[model samples]
Target chain A: SAVISQKPSRDICQRGTSLTIQCQVDSQVTMMFWYRQQPGQSLTLIATANQGSEATYESGFVIDKFPISRPNLTFSTLTVSNMSPEDSSIYLCSVYSPRQGGYTFGSGTRLTVV
Target chain B: AQSVTQLDSQVPVFEEAPVELRCNYSSSVSVYLFWYVQYPNQGLQLLLKYLSGSTLVESINGFEAEFNKSQTSFHLRKPSVHISDTAEYFCAVDQAGTALIFGKGTTLSVSS
Candidate 1:
């Protein structure tokens, strides 16, 4: 199975600030997804990051609010722009691995906006 | 489109007791089912999945889930649970070449 290393496991930020979460996969994968799990809520897909292309954002999400960068096959980053208290949530990255026969998720970044 | 439903928000049980976490899903196309466990302040770990073949799938641990197509259900069960089994369980569904859709997780609390 592929291992994903996500940084900034948690953070406390002030409103109007920005935070960029990163995920580095041990193995190269074609597609990587970003998800946000609000407190006491289910996981919601934010965007899909494909190498060498602009990410495809979900309906409720926008490029200006949540910009994704997929520089290469094994690396991706998601930035929460102009954070607000409502933006506080646990963000996770995932990759579908054929060898593992399922999706592998990162440890997740917990953001708290005040 | 696909969606998952976890009937229980929380399940409390004593150690060594039998437990079941119910899950149901709806999808127009053929889909895959997965059960994931997330410990406190940690990431999600794949518990088990039913991709094809037999309807029953078991994890390395005691947890098992049976895929029922007619009922559109994939409920997880363990004959005997341990205190270590305490965690949030999530049921997710995914169609071929698509992203996964997750259910609102169920938190399992196991005590002595």
Candidate 2:
């Protein structure tokens, strides 16, 4: 099992500002994913962070808005840019499964925009 | 595209009673089904998963879910409920080991 850690467990930001959430895994994973959960909603795949390449974002999410960086295996970051109250949600980092058995998740960053 | 459907958005049950959380999915090809639990102020943890072989899977905590291919369902069940079981449960489906499409999530509130 891999131990995943996320920085800034939570933060409240002002509108128009950007907040970057970092995810660090104890071991290298085959695939790393980012997810967003809006209040009273389900988890949505935001993007897939592949090391040394551009992040593959899902439809409705743009790199310009949610830039992702995977400096190396085991380390990744998701930046929510030009934040608005609508951007307020919980961002989570997850590892693709059964390597750690099922899916291991980071604690998540709870961001609230003013 | 694969999608999951959790019929109930919320379910309230008295502690020690039986509870069931329904989950259904739509996928043309083979897929993996999973149940996850999220406690307050915490991250989601996998409750169980159905990869292959047997259609029945059990979690360590006495939670069991059956994979009904004909019905396209993987519903979670616990014979007895507890206040500690109050949490948000998510049903997810993944085609292969790739992306996962999650259901809206069902909040299970077990009260005393």
Q: Name the best candidate (by lDDT).
A: 1
lDDT scores of the candidates, listed in order: 0.93, 0.92
Model 1: per-residue lDDT, tens digit, A1-114?
A: 889999899999999999999999999999899999998788999998899999998889999999999999999999999999999999999998876668989999999999
Give lDDT tens digits, candidate 1, residues B1-100. Answer: 6899999999999999999999999998789999999888777888999899999999999899999999999999999999999999999998863688
Which sections of candidate 2 miss by over 4 Å?
Answer: A98-101
Query: Quick one: best DockQ, which candidate?
Result: 2
**Residue A60 error, candidate 1, Å:** 1.2
TM-scores for candidates 1 onward, in order = 0.96, 0.96
> What is candidate 2's lDDT per residue for A1-114, written digit by digit as tens?
888999989999999999999999999876789999998778999998888889889999999999999998899999999999999999999887565346778998999999
Give the Å shift of residue B6 in candidate 1.
Answer: 0.6
Worst 10 residues of 1 chain A by lDDT: A96-105
Measured over all alpha carbons after superposition, the RMSD of each candidate to the real structure, in angstroms, is: 1.2, 1.2
Q: Which stretches of candidate 1 lie over 4 Å from their true place?
A: none
